[model samples]
Target: MKQITKAVIPAAGLGTRFLPAIKACPKEMLPIVDKPTIQYIIEDSGIKDILIISGHNKRSIEDHFDRNPELELNLEEHGKADLLEQVKAIADINIHYIRQKEPKGLGHAILCAKSFVGDEPFAVLLGDDVVYNDENPCLKQLIDVYNTYGGSVLGCQTVPQEKVSSYGIVASEATAAERIFKVNDMVEKPAVDEAPSRLAVLGRYVITPEIFSILERTEPGRGGEIQLTDALKVLAKQQNMYAYDFIGRRYDVGDKQGYLEATVEYALRREDLKDNFLEYLKKVVK
Candidate 1:
């Protein structure tokens, strides 16, 4: 099997929920504390050869990862050595981008990366969801499962019954190994009562190249856009697809409430900000 080295990040969403905040800025560029949310997704993926699938008004995502010589020089002139290193490190890795001409669905965004992905099994990390695990990054967990099983693996986490309608729900049969399931079926945004299971497919995916063919033939579903879930269902029928309940705390940073929670929780995790932030939070609550 090919080693999972390449990753595709779909950042083309219009982010209608963010409205004015995202009017001129890409939602993926929204900073959680100091780093862009997409940066967190990139780092979490543990893959340096990344191809970001971007769309209109998303040039900032590219600029964020590109070298800023003028800014670096200014930082040097100001004697901000530590800060300079951080800024430089952001552009130190190999990152590339391809624009998805239209605001197509996530499936189309991923389909744009076919040439970049070639024949290798690549991981897909959506900027909307950021999974945190210091010991094992979420994408790494999925890749490990893919390596072990020699097939596609989806990163899954259990969601509340009420929340099942918001995610692609999976029905699976348990494997002998813990937290791994042979996915039998998946329904995209099913009604609460009709959901097959609460095992929601999260943003992390380790998909084989065969999916590209499946996606190409998949007709647009739901909102008249090619749905990845639709293609995944077809893929599941043809191949051995497994879902692994990855160990991590997932934040749906795409949603307003989830975004705020991620920001606060992430701030608390920082050694330099935790004490002051926590004290401020305590004061505000009272």
Candidate 2:
């Protein structure tokens, strides 16, 4: 197997959930605390070469990572070296952008990156889902599984039975290794009663190149959009695919409640804001 050096981030969604706020700013650019949500995805991928699948009104995502000489000069003039370094570091990341051209769906957005990914196994991190892990990044954990197993690996976490309809739930049997499962089947956002299991597939994935061909012939499903889940199901039948119960707290930042929870938790984790934020939280609850 080849080393997973490339990553694809499907950020082309219009973010209808965010509505008025997202009308001007891309939801992927929404800040969790001080950093944009998409930045977390890029950093967690632990790779330099990344392709960002973007769409209309998503120019801010590109600008955020591109060099800003004026801003750098301003920070220098103000003697804010630390802030300058932080801004410069973001531009240093090797990011490539491609327009989805249409709001087809996740599968279409991913298919757009096929040229960039070439023949190598690549990681896909969704902009809406942010996984927080102090020790290992979620994408890295999936890549580790791909390295060991030589097949597609999904980073999954068990969600509540009631929430199974919100994700691509997988039916799988446990493997000999801890926190690993051999995926038998996948259902895209099945009704709670119809769901196979509570093991919902999150945004992180390490997929082999064979998926592109599978996606090519995949007809649009569920809302008349080409669903990645639909393609993955076909791939699962052709070869062994595994799901790793990744260690992390995943926040579906696309949802209003999940965004607030992520913001509060991320704020509480910061040393500069923890004490004051915790006190304020306590006061509010009381």
Candidate 3:
């Protein structure tokens, strides 16, 4: 099993959903609570080097990770040592940024990191999806499965039948106690009748270098975009592919409701906000 040292994060999307707010700020920079969404993914993965593929208007995302000495000094001088340390730690992780010249799609954004990832197996984490797992870090779990199986691993979860068409559905055979399945087929946003299974691919992925070639050859699919799901389907034909039902609560922040839900859930988890927020929720519900 190769040590998956590098990870790719595609943050180049235009994020038209939260237009006004995203006009000046990248969606990936949106805060879950006190930390930006991308920071959560980075901290969760615990990987050393992360390649963030951004677009023209996303330079602020890169700058957010860079050292902010003046801000840190101000925080420290204000007797906010904890906040200062927290901000300073953003620079601790090794991060590299690459620009996606065009909004081709997820696959294209990933292609921008080819040189950074080289020929080694790397992890791809969608910046918009946040997985809240208490038992194990979602990415780390997928990496462990990749180490044991030495193949592509996708993070998946069981969704209701009505929602199958909204995700990349997988047809798989049970292979482990942890809900890890050997994937036989995958379908992207298939209609209810066409879906392979109820298990939908989530945001986490551990893919081999072979995907780069497949992605290059894959034609644009839905929405005139080079869908990563299309490339994965091709890769599955050549090599073994597996899906792990990652243990976590995933928040799809791309949608308005999901974003609000994530904010409330994350805020409620914080010690400072938990009790009061829960009490407020009780009052509001009553």
Candidate closest to the true structure, highest lDDT: 2
For 6-120, candidate 3 gives per-residue lDDT tens digits of 9999998888999999999999988987888889889898898999988878888888899998898899889998888888888888999888888899988887888998889
True lDDT of residue 279, candidate 2: 98
RMSD of each: 0.8, 0.8, 1.3
Pull out the clashing pairs in model 3: none
Candidate 2 residue runs with Cα over 4 Å from true position: none
Model 2 C-alpha RMSD vs. true structure (Å) is: 0.8
Better of 1 and 3 by lDDT: 1
Tens digits of per-residue lDDT, candidate 2, 42-63, equal 8877999999998899999889
**Quality of model 3 by C-alpha lDDT:** 0.90
lDDT of 1 by residue, 104-195 (tens): 69899889999999999999988889888999888888888898997899999999999999999999999999999999899999999999
Local distance difference test, each candidate: 0.92, 0.93, 0.90
Badly placed stretches (over 4 Å) of model 1 are: none
Better of 2 and 3 by lDDT: 2
User: What is candidate 1's CA lDDT for residue 87?
Assistant: 95
Error of 1 at 12 (Å): 0.7
Task: Please report how far candidate 1 places residue 115 from its true position, in Å.
Answer: 0.7
